[model samples]
Target: MPKKLIQRFSPKPETLKAHPHLKYFGEILQNPNLWHLNRRSAAGAVAIGLFCAWMPIPFQMLLASLLAMFFCVNLPLSVALVWISNPITMPPLFYGAYRLGASILNEPIREFHFELSFHWLAHAIETIAPALLLGSFILGVISAASGYFMLRILWRINIANKWQRRNKK
Candidate 1:
């Protein structure tokens, strides 16, 4: 990861500390690990963020933030990455997860029309919740592991390249 790039874009600790809503978090937000842009923190944040992004629930950012805090990872990066499943990509991602889950469970795929109502949501959940949850969990784990390892590998490679150039100098 480009530490400077991430640091530049991430919210400043002072800004977060000054926010009224964030005041509830108090000293917890003051943890140095949560703001550090090092390899381990960055990789762990990626894993935490990606995993939460696949979750079939509201407030993925909150989940990512909590996980980041618990794991002592980069907090802002983890929360920001949960936007991967925003309004535009959510439908397709959930649909794919549902399909994968149904296949894994050997259940027949059902064709249902979408409706913007509480009744429809309730009915849909009753029929599809199992497969959707299962598939989402599977995908989340895969995404988290892939993100963690990929970041770790890329960070190591970047360091090695920098070392080589310095040696040549």
Candidate 2:
């Protein structure tokens, strides 16, 4: 008969120290009463970040950071989250925005014929410029505000649950 080897169940210490940025790594962390405050700020930041990401405007990350600071949100995290929109997603998002804006304005959707030249690009811009700007701003504000409210509710519930758990212990 062959002998079977048993694996140890101990967790590695390095794996446990996951988030280095957090103040308390493995210690008994004290619960703070300012839970609602932090939660609201974080929620607002995430919401604004997502909106900024989806907006077709240039330099969106910078705009998001400035907005986050002005709105008193978690600036670093909000700005970081704005990367949700990248080059890969830009084309589809811009197309959708254009469609929406054209529909709303009772204008027929213009079809683009892509050519391998800078002249074609300039023509495309001239055609869609108005719709792009209008749609991007509208969608950005709508998405951002929606995200803010949804996150706010979620954070409130989570914080309340944590507060209750700490009190129970």
Winning candidate number (TM-score): 1
List, residue by residue over 16-36, the lDDT tens digit for candidate 2. Answer: 235464335234212221111
| Candidate 2 Cα errors over 4 Å, as ranges | 1-37, 114-118, 167-169
CA lDDT of 143 in candidate 2? 79
C-alpha lDDT values of all predictions: 0.94, 0.67
**TM-score of every model versus the real structure:** 0.96, 0.68
lDDT of 1 at 98: 95
What lDDT score is found at residue 157 in candidate 2?
78
Clashes of 1: 0
Worst 10 residues of 2 by lDDT: 1-10
Candidate closest to the true structure, highest lDDT = 1
Global lDDT for candidate 1?
0.94
